[model samples]
Target: MKQDTALSERPAVGATPTGPDPERAAPRYTGGQIRNILIGLMLAMLTSMLTNSIVGTALPTIIGELGGQDKLAWVASASLLTMTATTPLWGKLSDIYGRKPLFQVSLVIFIASSVAAGFSTDISWLIGARLLQGVGMGGLVSLPQIILGDVVEPRERGRYSGYLGAVFGVSTVAGPLLGGFLVDSPLGWRWCFFITVPLAVVSFGVIQWLLRMPAHERTANKIDWWGATCIVGSAAAVMLLLSLGGKEFAWNSPVTYLFIVVALVLAVSGVFAERRAEDPIMAPRLFRNPTFVLAGLASLLVGVSMFGVMIYFPQYLQIVKGMSPTASGLMTLPLVVGMLSASISSGMLVSRTGKWKIYPVAGMLLVSAGFGVLSLLQVHSSIALVGTGVGLIGLGLGLSMQILILATQNALDRADMAAGTSAVTFFRNLGGAIGVSAFGAIMTNSFSSGFRSVGAEAIAAGASPDELAVAATGSPAAIHALPDAVRELVLGAFNDAMHHVYVVGAPVALAAFVVVLFLRPTPLRSHT
Candidate 1:
């Protein structure tokens, strides 16, 4: 018999089946069906991971063509803001509806946005499409893990989860390359958006044909509209606060203060709404599990370190070490390699040993140590040294990422799995958005402070304030175009500011290191 989408309480693995019903003894997946389903899921997983990194190298070109030189950062920020806010809703909806329709809907939305984005004639148009694209990306990011958990047992999920990590590696490693090449070619930057359309279509077809679950018999399932509204509102407010504050508006400005208050109010209201909700989108019971709480914290802190490195490290190389945009992206490849190898290795080991606690603990320590090493990098640092430092952090991420998911999933019953997974992902992505904004603010403030003396001396010597200001806030090319003496000073300022950013982040990583030690050593269940 097929299981209902709103899953019933089932026997724990190795326990006796309830009531000896003949249909309850059937295996979850037929062998042939399982292969097709996993392949379908892998494609959906690839699209989301690919979307994140694909436009990285092309963003400058995209903004250049679209005439959004001043609004360059919003290109990426828009997608992240929407995706992070919508994730929990996707997970909860899959619980109420079957996974296939929701997943397919997301694929359609993503493809349509990609098509729209490719045709964008202005920055506002492109940002609007990307914001819509995030709605799809949200589902892509969360639902694959939930679907895999639906099909695979906890002990076995590592192998599949490692595949997700592998796609993450491949995507990060290759996305910039593809984007750069396409942007440089006559096909131009728009092709970057066009490329994913075909992939999305294939993913949609594969999912529709191969992915199936029992239609959620929704006789008793009620949508918690108030809880949903408050959670999404609060999340949107928080993301907006992170993305806009200190950049568009002062940190202490009325806009910032208003959002802070709005987010807090909605969040409190959401919590109360959830408590009384018949089918809470966020289960209160999940938080009661120490594993879920610790794992959520670990995911959040890990996200900060992860996004912080991705955002600042490239700029560090380009400005401080005088590498080109392409080279800076390529220089980060070792991080991808380390992450892929470690994630797959840890996954396999966990499956074989059925033990996972030590990986995250050790991984967090490595992350802290890596960030500490990153703090020590100088303008004169060699590429090999940079790779070593970044690779350590990547290895830590590989070890920690999937393990945290597994830890949280193992703690939950069947009904809570989707919500639990979404909650973890939401926090992690939320951390990334916050990390980008906070660290960007740090970089900007530090650069200004570091350049103050340089700027004063230059003005004293008769250079234009406009020129110096452009050098301080401009792109790598602009900075490099300055006079030799001014260029060197600008470079030093960037190097110092980035180094300080890493130092500030090291303690945050250490906090994650400390938190993971408290994770209870729960035994892995090999069967669902």
Candidate 2:
């Protein structure tokens, strides 16, 4: 029988002589597709994080060699800026253009950029390559959710999302260590970028060979070019202001005010465009759900605290605690372990019980505890204790982050899956940019003040403040070559500077805890 109408909300089917009827479509994901997709996705996620984390350990060397010490944050922030800005656009494009092409395109771009980034002779070139790389990286993170949504029902996704968390945990654990070893063992830092090239090629080949998805029927409609421009402009402008405020200019500077105005105007225009556009870049409707809104806010806070703090931990160990880069990388194992264990365990538990709301409650509490403890860390504190504090933060993060995405997907209609996931990702990235900029600012200011306080004693003893300031960062080879007394003074200044940063970060983390507590309890729906 040929169906004249859609069958049970599925696509229409064939008709027969006896009667015209509709047929229910089989599930989109079958056994082969499921297994292959999982393999491809895991590899993709693993490679992405591994690449990002590996670069963190090598950044100091890369920036120093290129003579753009002031542009260090740009290497990271530029990547993040593009990644955050384009993630939502990728999601929307995936929905319209299909995931396979977009996913493969991202991999190709990332690999190409990785190769180019390695060959760069200066920080500006490196930063530009990194920025280009983010376009690809953004797709890597965004498409997995869309593909999974298309195949798996909401309830089943919790378990699979757990797999992603595990991948993230492992990458976080392994990346810096691997990077540290490579940088220290005569390979130099460029290999950090080169290393991802082969893996990316393999990932792309595997995905092309093994993965297939239903082709999307692209509709004829005007793309929201204006909306996208506004959104991207707004995000970039705001992040730029945040990053440069306390570094390149004073908080009250005219340049800062101009950027602030630009951000506000673009943001306002984006809101207007989204409301009027037939198809929007960032759907405002998602924010209509209070739970989604609250959860998004929470995710933002999590991103801010998590990325801002963890990214600096290696510097702290190398600088204040006087550990080698490799040793500092090793010290992060506890945090990654905690993150992996908690993420995997909590994911399985949520799948089993279909109860997820309470984990965030507990996770946020632990995060607050971790941050509070971390603020107390000094040059004299036990390395093990510092590790324990990071583990606590990881535990909280592992529980709360993925669950929020799961919850948001569950709450939305299946048709809205891409938008919902992108919304969460967007806010989290925004929060991360803000966190890194704000915290980095605090650290810089504190460093200057701390150095001033310690300068007299340091100079009286024969070391200059300039030398001490350079040593406080600890990653530069020049720092390693300094006299022991000068190095000690630098380390002391670094410890004091970090103490100030941590103290401020702790309160922000605590605020996340308070917000999570108020999130309404909701059941984990198996299907949206």
Most lDDT-accurate candidate: 1
TM value for model 1: 0.92
Residue pairs with backbone overlap in model 2: 1-14, 1-15, 1-16, 2-14, 2-15, 2-16, 155-526
Rate residue 9 of model 2 by lDDT: 43
Q: Each model's TM-score?
A: 0.92, 0.88
TM-score of 2: 0.88
Deviation from native of the Cα of residue 82 in model 1, angstroms: 1.1
lDDT of 1 by residue, 315-356 (tens): 888888778877877888889888899998998898888899
List where candidate 2 sits over 4 angstroms from the true fold.
1-35, 63-73, 121-124, 185-188, 460-492
Q: Global lDDT of each model?
A: 0.81, 0.76
Error of 1 at 209 (Å): 3.2
Residue pairs in steric clash, candidate 1? none
